[model samples]
Target: MCIPPEAQWKRATIPDRRSVPFFGQGRGLTDSQSLDSIPPPPSPKLRRAQKVAEQKAQRIQDFKQRCGPGFSSSSAWQARPWQHRIAIEQGIRKQDALPEEMEVVEDPTIEEPVGINPVQVEVGEFEEPTVDVEEIVAENPCQNYHCKHGKVCELDENNTPMCVCQDPSSCPASTAVFEKVCGTDNKTYDTSCHFFATKCTLEGTKKGHKLHLDYIGPCKFIPECLDTELSEFPLRMRDWLKNVLVTLYERDEDNNLLTEKQKLRVKKIHENEKRLEAGDHTVELLTRDFEKNYNMYIFPVHWQFGQLDQHPVDGYLSHTELAPLRAPLIPMEHCTTRFFETCDLDNDKYIALEEWGNCFGIKEKDIDKDLVI
Candidate 1:
């Protein structure tokens, strides 16, 4: 019935929870000790190497699967295992060895390793290599060439780039027949491309130089332009030019067809209350309006000439340069050919600025080179 002192003392000293071990103790350890006991995570270099090895192994397995059992019997595949082993050993040595421990020696007596053949060399045994300039030029000679207008460069049998007539089919398709044109020979072409291509085909002949784009639309019975009509041409043309610039200014709110410089010059004509609007006008109306607003017509006429004289800018309008304006007008305006023919005062095949102004009735004293803009 009496409790022993030793048992009472033992009960009092004993704890209710389990005991945690001290550092470096058996069975139970501290957090730091536990972390230290665990193996350190692999180094970044080692992890990367392992990943690469795994990828290589996977690729090899995939190749084997695709090639089947017969693949292993092939010479390349048979030699692969040895190659892989050698590669792995070399990689390990590279990673583990110090820079000083690595040595490279030229062994002339040793047999050449697999997949490598040695080239024997002796002093002053070199020969100068011959180069074929023609072969080099043949590779892409067309890249250095530029063909004339309406023509194209083509490679011949000798791989030389030569100017040739462009295929008519290569020209863009016309959306409407209204885009068709008539040549001087009274033949109707599908588009300007057909006409130019035909001209290019006749390059060396006298007929080629004579051939010209006559008019817009198609061939029709064009009455001969009389001298009286030629005299009246400038009056109508000046009025038309002024009206064109004014109309362009009015519609140019959203469309930026006119440059800032062009718009500034056109603004004066746009605001002129007395200026005649575009329409079918009599020669009397054209001449009277031009006289009333002569200054307004001058700039637009000069501007048009400048725009057309772009290809060679030598103050002369070439046939190609005049095509845009002249071709379209010839069919509609009966006086077009005669007016232009008269503009070439010297019959030099080019329309000089002075001659152009004279054709438009600009006074000799008022004709200025600065107004070409």
Candidate 2:
């Protein structure tokens, strides 16, 4: 049968389904209808890239799962309506279609709760923080230290604090020569401060340790002590000490220098007219007066020792500790050195209370430590 002209023309113009451009237009069509059929097998490089992409996606999913609801990779996509529409179009349908316009309108019917309960998190009790011992030691390492008067604290290589004699130059300057003192070495210092500072600088040396402040004034010719004078020295010194205390008691109306306990003790001696006043008495008069007022002499010697033994209070006199009493006496009294040297009966460097009392001619029974006021 011959086909009609209109039907023939229509059939000729219609393209074959296989020949028409489809999703995989460049690739030849086959009977298969799956995504694998649409595209050919990728190159080795592309396959490797695809594998890497799949692994990255899997890692992201695992990270989200581990983090729970606290983490989300698609938060930005979810926040944007345009992104959400694009994602939906790409994932659900690949056709060009206009997205439905969405208007966000607040719903008045959805009311907030009138009174919501606040989240009450149960907290554990707080504990005091513990400090490290090293940290405590490191903090103000120089604190709680003891150094000599003219010395300072310093840290060593191991970060340990130590005492070192201060530089003499660091000491404050003397305003006048009135403050000057002379050393036994015949050296005159600008001030007592300068003398002590120089002495500190010479610490641990033989000459320095032996050196001492000789007098209040500059150095002068001090006569050598004779044997007779040395024997009489203690008598004069005892008398001097008693007189000094009496003088202090008489003048201590303000209660500034002597304590009330000390004043009470000295008051008895002050009232005693039999007590010899401080004067240049003959040796016979001194000896007679001391024999009569033996009790008066005991307290002064003990008091002097107590004053000198203060730095460590070990009941012994160190050379430096004896400076205040010994220094001034050394220049004025020629027998001072011989007297003190004889006092150390045991030949020990320090002078014990017993030795000191014995040297002053106090009887053994009367040489009481209790008298050290």
Candidate 3:
């Protein structure tokens, strides 16, 4: 039979206890237990303290890594990237000192000892007592173009004025494209088939080869003279002038045969004329309808004055040849030449007019003595 509940409770009521191992406590133990022996369940304060300690330790490790093996001395610890760099740099400067390379220059004012041989004294002498006209002048020691000592006025290959070779390695004309050849050929066929056609034309017959090679270099401009600036007008201005000026010369039916490039020529003359009127001193031009032999300040730009019936001169031909000099002229569409012929006449050189007057219709008489073409 079980004892009654009240008697059982009374028997077990004696007050005795042993220690709790995790809490490190015997009966009524003090709170200063070894932390390693009995760790408390982590609290917010304990966790925060642990994190702070970890970060501090990490920072110390990083500092040690930066300092390397030589950082054993406490006084040499550098806490910043820049400060550490400076310390290393100082060490390097000390290690790499170049005392043997030192050059000692004497003060010119100091006089040599009286007993010293005159030859040795003269050999070392640099300062002259006074600049005498009779005394031989020292020859210039600078090399050509390498020394900034040359007079700055010098002409480049293109005759453009430039700085002399003070900085020999840096030439102002170095980046300039002294020569450039810009050109495009008519496709005639679609892009893909054109290549095959070009090949067939080139290889099948010498005549075809001569034809295809003609379209090279920039389209020649018709100006009365040697001014490259006026000959190559800005494209937009040329286009605007072409639209308006060619209208002055071409009839719709006649213009149908002229190339787009020919149309641009007519446009440039017109545009430049307006610029000239605006005091730009552009060259005045006369387009003669070689067919009618009608000389006028401006051509009937709409009417196509095509190629001459006979070669004006038997030599190399070019796009400029498409221009007519006499009446009953055929347009370029009608008067054709071989391809290679276009590249002839000093192929690399351009057709330069002797003077501006020969390029435009205006002769020396028409020009005022004070005016420039």
Clashes of each: 0, 0, 25
Model 3: weakest 10-residue lDDT segment is: 13-22
lDDT of candidate 3 at residue 58, scale 0 to 100? 55
Which tens-of-lDDT digit does each residue in 1-373 have in candidate 1? 2233223322432231111111111222222332234343355544544444344455555665666655442344334445433433444454444243346777678645445636755546777777767644335677779887578889899877898889888888677878888888889888888889988888789998899888888799988998898888788788878877787888898757788888888888788899887788899888888888888888988888988998888899988899899988887788888888888989989999999998888888888888777
lDDT of each: 0.71, 0.69, 0.33
Query: Tens digit of lDDT per residue, candidate 2, span 1-373?
Result: 3233223322432232221122322232222332232333344432543443344456555665666656554443235445323332343232123253468888777544445735443344446678767634446677878877667889999999998877777767778765778887889888776787788888899988877777777777878889999889988898998899888888888998788878878888888889886788889999999999888787888887888998778889976787788877876787887788888888888899999889999989987887786
Off by over 4 Å in 1: 1-146, 155-162, 169-175
Candidate that beats the other on TM-score, 1 or 2, i.e. the better one: 1
- For TM-score, candidate 1 versus 3, the one ahead is 1
Off by over 4 Å in 2: 1-146, 154-161
Q: Order of candidates by TM-score, top first? A: 1, 2, 3
What is the per-residue lDDT of model 3 for residues 313-369, given as tens digits with 9 covering 90 to 100? 422223434322211111121122221122234553222221222233334354332
Off by over 4 Å in 3: 1-349, 353-373
